[model samples]
Target: MFFFMAKKDRDYFLSFIAIVFLILHLHVSANEEADRIISLPGQPKVAFQQFSGYVTVNEVAGRALFYWLTEAVQQPSSKPLVVWLNGGPGCSSVAYGASEEIGPFRISKTTSGLYLNKFSWNKLANLLFLETPAGVGFSYSNRSSDLFDTGDIRTAKDSLQFLIRWLDRFPRYKNREVYLTGESYAGHYVPQLARQIVNYNANTNHKINFKGFMVGNAVTDNYYDNLGTVNYWWSHAMISDKTYKQLMSTCDFQRQKESNECESLYYYAMDQEFGNIDQYNIYAPPCNNSDGSSATRHNMRLPHRPHSAVQLYSGYDPCTEKYAEIYYNRPDVQKALHANISGHIPYKWTACSETLNRNWNDTDSSILPIYRELIAAGLRIWVFSGDVDAVVPVTATRYSLAQLKLDTTISWYPWYVKKQVGGWTEVYKGLTFATVRGAGHEVPVFKPRAAFQLFSSFLQGKPLPKS
Candidate 1:
């Protein structure tokens, strides 16, 4: 067909084709430069590209959310996109999720360097960590009042907007299979965000390729969570018989508000149960220098205090949180991450924002109803618990699932990783529940290999290994 064309016309068509190709090439090149992370301070050499910056969700308010993305270790273009959130209701996914748990690197023991995290989730997916709600981590809002005016509904709306803008910035991920995963309060964040995405898809021309979501040690139903906490403490023999009796007799789990006597007894029981230990992982040692002043702060679930290199079970570092705080605050480090570029952020970065936690509003008593809706929509849902986490224990999660009354498709059984039992799992009609053995509130930080295996199975939509 080309040979049949007149010589001048054929040359003209060839030139047009060349021009189109050049334009396409330049488009990709521009995107690469715009999102490229030059380098991170003290970062180890790596094969994958990383990017960090703000995606403005509201231009008028100067509201932006911070994100750090690590492309998959291999064939990133073909892999799924996994967004991870950490649940303090005010936690920084960058500080907790990225630095200490599942990102490509962890703060070195020396506190001044970085080291490779062999079990980084990006090995199998393009992992994204978001610091959301406008006041956590490096995310910020220009309006001072906006920092304190955040809640579950507002956070979800802002997060949906952040995702839409983020996709515009990194358009390559627009069509990828998207999965939401988070721990603790993220139990609330993940479901709410998923619901918003579903609603957006239903109403708008632009669509998100939403697949499924996974949560660990999540706060789902306050009634079950509180009840389970008491039961867990009693079962673990952490509380006295009298305290247990008081909890059972005086505290009404079903009540929206408990009596003064019940509140007193509950606090007493918690004090007896936790003492000076790290409540997130009962068996793990508390940060040596911690004075226990933050013990009553539930939102500060995984507080890290600097300590000596005394190894604990699973080689978990009790001081990783402190190390992350120091690393993130370094001027050069912030510059490398493209964080706090405006110099207008009022506070230094912390793993969890105390102000945000105090000001949080519009919390739903239970997210179980949202779960039910998502399940019926046929989205693959998996709920996991770190068995050693007392903050939101496995017992609480189990009780919450029981309330849903989803019939078991597969009976409870041990799941394996590396020829060893990593956890126990059960498949229900609409969800899968699993427990990670010997893990704490942050499963990946406490049991990296098992956590990675669980993540791999979830992304593949396969049941955990039985052998």
Candidate 2:
């Protein structure tokens, strides 16, 4: 059996040969896969076709390693460049950005029409799709193994390395305003990466132009984000009120040690399993405890294990060909699976597989303070939320932000697109928070109109869309 180092245990001083097994392949320039600088077919809409670049860093064994992205064409002044990362701590941003979110296309739910989004965000911002952390998708390492969860520090290091090199590859945009954005657990990813940029600017003599950040349905604070969000989800009718009140009273939000086997009322309620999830036999989206039902809010619990990972990702190949290219079964993705690593290590289930169950460290020492630090340093911070997600619901986001206590008065307004009110906006303390009404965890997939308006505001560092 192959053994690997937990990120916490890795000794930087280990012998190079002992770490050689971690080098899955040596990345000599000749052997490295050059990134595809895509062209948007010179359509009347495009000023330029596309640009692409890669960030190369050394493997744990000191071998060359790389991650890259394709930047869709954009009008320099009219459009801002937005780098989007999806938070699996392992999932590829490109898979989510291109396949699901607003990068000019989307999957047809019914199969007849192409289901054009009519509100793609990239039309307003130059979209860049990144495959990060070296093992998520086309991203691979010559390194035979990776520390599971890899933690926030390593993710930040890799992302900073990626940003510095990516800027080097496309210097024309060096001065162009850049925004860091993502969804799901990216509550941490966006800020963590942003913190690095802020730190680099403060600590080093170098200057890589960075503008601001945006996070949707994110995991902000472990206690408030995880436990409080669940409670707020119930209050919003996504779950039962009784379940929430009970959880608030009995369930300790801080420790948040959830498990399926636990007999706590919290577990008993979420353990709800319908024999099948067919519409006729559906468990109604929970409402307040007053709704006629045996289930209570106390019954709602974060899924014990991540949605699909704890159950199974094996033998499941979802329909992806309908969208872009289906690379789920590719030999390259299959080869990078660290099965020998703990089951805690994740693999894609469908494309967005690493949602709930993640070995990530959600403790307090993360980028929270760094966000305040950045705000103090004059960085523009925008926190956006998708109202539909029960997990990481917007209310929980509100709870966390209220704590920041920024000096700017919160502005309640609406963002308009095509002259129609698209979403709600609040700007405070040099930070703006927007809520996409119809959207879920992945906002672009559900609310592209608001997404575009957002990037437009993001690039300009303006307030969020007016509702």
State residue 465's C-alpha deviation in candidate 1, in Å.
0.6
How do the residues 1-467 of candidate 1 rate in per-residue lDDT, one tens digit apiece? 99999999999999999999899878866765665788788888898989888888989998899998999999999999999988777888988889878899988878778989989999999999999889988999998888687889989999999998888778788899999999888988999999999999999888999999999998888789878977887888778888888888887776645778887786676665557666677787755656644322332221111111111364566667778789999999888888998896768888888778767766777889999999988899999999887778899899988989999998999999999999999999989999999888888878889999999999999999998
Predicted structure 2: lDDT = 0.55
Cα RMSD of predicted structure 2: 12.6
lDDT of each: 0.83, 0.55
> Candidate 2, residues 39-152: lDDT per residue as tens digits?
222112434344333345554533122333334445545556678887655565655666556665444433322333466666666677666655554454454344344456
Q: What is the lDDT of residue 162 in candidate 2?
A: 76
All candidates: TM-score: 0.90, 0.71
Off by over 4 Å in 1: 1-32, 254-259, 290-314
